[model samples]
Target chain A: MSSLAVGCRLRVAVLVLALLGAGAVGGGSTAHAADDGELTLDSIVNNVIVGHAEDGNYLNFDPFATVELPRIMVARTADGALTVDLYGSTKGLLKDGTYGLVPHSEGEGGHEEVITESSALQEAFASKAHLHGDIVRTSGHVVADLSITRHLIFGLLAMGIVLAIFLVLAQRYKRGVGRTEAPHGVLQNMMEVMVVFIRDEVAKPNIQGEKWRTFLPYLLSAFFFILMANILGLVPYAGAATSNIAVTGVLAVMTFVIGLLYGSKDHYKHMFLGPPDAPWPIRVILVPIELIGTVMRHLALAIRLFANMMGGSLIIFSLIGLVFIMNVLFGEAMAFGTSIISIGFTVFILLLKLLVAFIQAYVFTILSALFIGISVEEHEHEEHADDAHAEAPTSQTSGALSDRLDAVDDAVDDVTEPAPA
Target chain B: MTEVIAQSLVQPDVGLIFWKTIAFLIFLFLLYRYGWGPITEAMESREEEIESSIQRAEEALAEAKEIQSENKKARREAEREAQRILREARESAEELREEEMAKTRDRIQQMQEQAQAEIEREKQAALQELRDEVADLAIEAASKVVRDDLDGERQRKLVNDFIDDLPKN
Candidate 1:
C-alpha cells in the first residue's frame, strides 16, 4: 500500500510538472501580445480571488466545461440615461456592442482601447471587464456596473441549498415524522444535531434568558449560510462567499444592528457614562473608550472571518502556484521535482482549510451570540441595590439607623446569593 | 506589493452587500417561519416525551419494588402462621394422649378394688357353709350314740355347743 501511494504521488508530480511546463511555454509566447501574464502568480490570484461578475460567464472548472451564471448590469447610454441590461451570456453582450470591454492598460498611448468585436476575444478576455466590479464602456464613457459576481452567485446558491435542506427537514418535523418517531435519515439527524448545538451550546449559554430564542433564527441562518458557503468554496471552481469582505461586512452589520436594537438601558448607559458608581473623573476617561470598543469589536468580527477564509484559499493557491513559478524561474526538471513538494503542501493546506471553514462559522455565530448576550443582560443586581437603599431609614432616629444598617446587610446578601448564572 | 494584496483582500462591493443583506434577511425569515420554528418545537416536544416516559418508567419500577417487598412480607407472615398452627396441633395431640392415659389408670384402680371386695365376700360365705356341714355331722354321730343310751334334747344342746367350738377351731 505504501509503495502504491508513493507511485501515485510520483505520477501526480509528473502530471503537475507537465502542466506547469506547458503553461510556462504558453505564457512566454503569449506575454508579448497579452497585457496580463498568463499563469503568473497575479493571474492565479485574480482568478481565485473575488472579482466583479461577467454575464453568462460560467466558473471554469476545466478548459472544456464551465458553470454559467446570469449577468445583470446597470449601464448609461451616450445621453446619460441609465439602462439595465440583462444578457444570457457575456458573449451576447459582446455581440451586441452596446457595451465594450475596456483594456487593463492603455500602453504608452493615453487612449483606452475598447474591444467591440468577437474577433477581439483574446483582447476582451485580457481586459476582464466581464468581471462584476470592472467598468464597461457605453459610447466611450465608463458606466456603473452592478452585476452579479462569481462570489454572489455562489452565495445565493449556498443560501438556496441551505433553504432547501432545512425546509424539507422542517416539513418532516411538522408532519410528525421526526417529532413522534426517531429521526430517519442522515440529513435530518445532522440538521437536528446542528440546530440543537446552536440552541443549547451557542445561544443558550451566551444570549441567556428568553432573548436567545428571539435571536436563535438569525444565528442559525448565519451559521448555516457561512458554513455552506465555506464548504462550497472548496469545490473546484466555486468562490467562498465568506472570503469576500463585503459579505462578512453585511453579516457584521446585521449583528451590530441587532445588538443595538436589543441593547438594554444599562448597556447604553455603560457605553456612554461608564458605571454608575464610578467617580466623575474615572467616568470621563472610560466612556469614550467603552463606546469605541463596541464598534471595534464588531469590525474585528467581520475582518476575522473574512481573513481566515481568504487566507486559507490564498495559501492553497500560492502552494499550487509555486510549481508554475518554479517552472518559470528554474529549469523544467527542477520544476518537476518541486511539484511533489508543492502538491503535498497544497493537499495538507486544503485539509486545514476544511477545518477552518467549520471553525470560522462556529466562531462567527458564538461571537454574535456573545455580543447580543451582553446587550440584553438585565441589571438585576443594580435594581436590588437601589431597592435596598430606598428602604433605608432616616438618620434622625438612632435606633432606626441601626435597623437600616441591618437592612442594607440583608439586601447585600440577597443581591449576592442569586447572582445570574 | 502590500497595497496590491490589501486591495484584493479588502474590496467590498456595495451592490454585493446590499443584495446579500436582502437575501440573508429573506432566508432568515423564511427559515424561521418554516424551518427552525417547527424543528425546534419538535425537538422540544420529543425531549419532553422522552423525559416523561423515563419518569413513568421509574415510577413503575418503584411501584414494582414496593409490591415485591409487600409480597415478601406477606409470604413471611404466612410462613409464621403455618408454623404456629403446626405447633399448636402437636401440643393439642400431646395433651389428648396424656389425658387418655390418666383416665385408663383411674379405671384400672377402681376395678382392682372391686375385685378384692368380691374375693373377701366369697371367702366368708365358704367358711359359713363349712361350719354348718361340720355341725350336722357332729349331731348325727351324737344321736347314734344316744339311741344306745340318753334322750334327743341333750343331743341338740351338745350339737349346738359343738358347732360353736368347731368355729373356734
Candidate 2:
C-alpha cells in the first residue's frame, strides 16, 4: 500500500501569514491531498493530532509545505550507554539503524502488535502513521522521545498568529484607531467586544481594588491565544494545541504560579493553617483538603480543556470515518449514501465546535483570573469591612451609544423608505 | 489495550511541556510588553474621552436650557413693557383729548360772554335813541301847546323828572 500517513499540503508559515485554513477539512484536502488507500477509524482519529508526514514535513489542511523538523531523542544501547541525537526526519532517524518506528498497534499505546523487521517499520509508517511513536533502538529503547511534534508546530503557529494580529492592532492603536475615536471595522469591533467583556464581565468583577488593570495584559493574552488556537482547530486539517494536555497543563501551571506569586499572606495561611476558629480536629482535615483542592482544581483545569477539544476532534473524525467503514462493508454506492449522513453530522459538530472554541478560551482565561483574584482576595472581619466600593459605571456614553444607534436606525429607515415606496 | 490508548490520550508529553513552559513564558512576556499595553491604554484613553465628552454634552444641554429659559423670561418682560407702554399711550391720549375739550369750552364761554356784553351795550344805545325821539316829539307838542302854554324850561324839567322816575332796574 501507499505510505499510511494522510494529509493536505500545508505549512506553519502559510497558516500564520494567511490566517485562513478553512480549506484543510473541507473539499481542499479531500480533492488535492487525498490518501491513496482507504481510511481506518483509528487512522482518521489519530490524524487529528498527527498530520501526514510522508512527503517531508507538511501542515495537514493547507497546500504550503515546510522542511521536516528535527527529531531530538534519548537512546540507550544494550551496554546501558545513553546518547541523545537529532535527525532531520523519521526517515533519516531510521536510516541510522539506531532507531526504528513501531505502529501503535504493535506498540504499547493504541493499536498493538510486534515489530520484527524492516517490513514492520514500513507498516508502522503507514499512510495514517505519525512520527510520534515508540522509537526502538537496536537492542535498546528510547528513554526520552523529546521530538518536536506536530502539535508543537501548530502551537507555535498559533502563537505566531496571536503575535501577528496584535502587532498590527498595536500599530493601529498607535495611529489612534480606537483611542481618539470609537473603534471602527470588524477586527477592531470584534476585538473590543472581547476586551471589554474580559475587563468588565470577567477581570474587573473578580479582581478588586481596580487591580484588574495589573492583570489585564495576562488575561487578554490568555484569552486571545487560546481563542486563536481553538479557532485554528476548526480549520479543516488544522487542529488546536489546547487539545493536548501538555499545553493546557502548562497554561494551568502558569495560573497556579501566578496565583501563588500574587497570593495574599492570608491565602497561604488559609490553605495551610485552615480556619483558625475551627477546632484542631477540623483544622487538620481542612488543611489537607484545601491543599489537595488547589492542585486538583488546576489539574482539572488542564484536563477539562484537553478533553473538550480532543472530544470535538474525535467526534468529527469518527463521523467522517463512518463513510469509509460503510464503503468497506457494502459497496461504493453505499459509501456515498453514508457520506450524506456523515457530512451532515460533521457540519453540525463543526458549528458547535466554533461556539465551543470561544467558550473554552473565555472559560480558561476567566477561571485563571478568578483563581488569581481568589489568591489576592483579602479576608477581613465584617466590622472592618468597607461597603463603599461598588461597580463603576461601565460607560458614560452607554446611553449615547443607544441614542446614536437609534438615530442611525431611523436615518437608515428614512433613507430607504422612499425607495420601497 | 484500550486502557493503554485511553491513558495515552491524557498523558502529558514531557517534551511538549518542557517546550511549552518556555514558549508560554515568552508569550506572556512579549504580549505584556508589546500586544496588550497599547491596546488597553488606548481603550482606557477612549473611555476617559467618552466620559469627558458626555460631561461636556450634559453641560451644553444645561447651558442651552438656561439660555432658553432666559430668552423666555426676556420675552415675557418685553411683552409686559409693551403692555405698559400701550396703557400709558392710551392714558396720555385720553388726557390730551380732555385737555383740548376743556380749552374749547373755555373759549366758547368767553365768546358768549363778550356777545352778551355787546348786546347789552347795543340795547342801552337803542333805548337812548328812543328816549331822544320821545324828547323831540314832546318838544314839538310843547311848541304847539306853548301858544296856550307856560315856558320851555318848565317843559324840560318835567321830562327830566319823568325820565328819572322811570325804574332803573
**lDDT (C-alpha, whole model) for all candidates:** 0.70, 0.69
Which ranges in model 1 have alpha carbons more than 4 Å from their true place? Answer: A1-58, A76-82, A106-111, A121-133, A139-144, A381-421, B1-6, B118-169
Which candidate leads in lDDT?
1
lDDT of 2 by residue, A160-275 (tens): 88988888888789899899977879988988888889989878877767778888888888888898888888876566888888889999998899898988876787789876
Model 1 over residues B1-169: C-alpha lDDT tens digits?
Answer: 2222336457687667767888888988899889889988999999999999999999999999999999999999999999999999999999999999999899899988898888888878887887777767776788777776768778878788766675463
Candidate 1: clashing pairs of residues: A52-A131, A52-A132, A52-A133, A53-A131, A53-A132, A54-A130, A55-A90, A58-A67
Minimum summed lDDT over a 10-residue window in model 2 chain B is located at B1-10
- TM per model? 0.77, 0.75
Docking quality tier of candidate 1?
acceptable
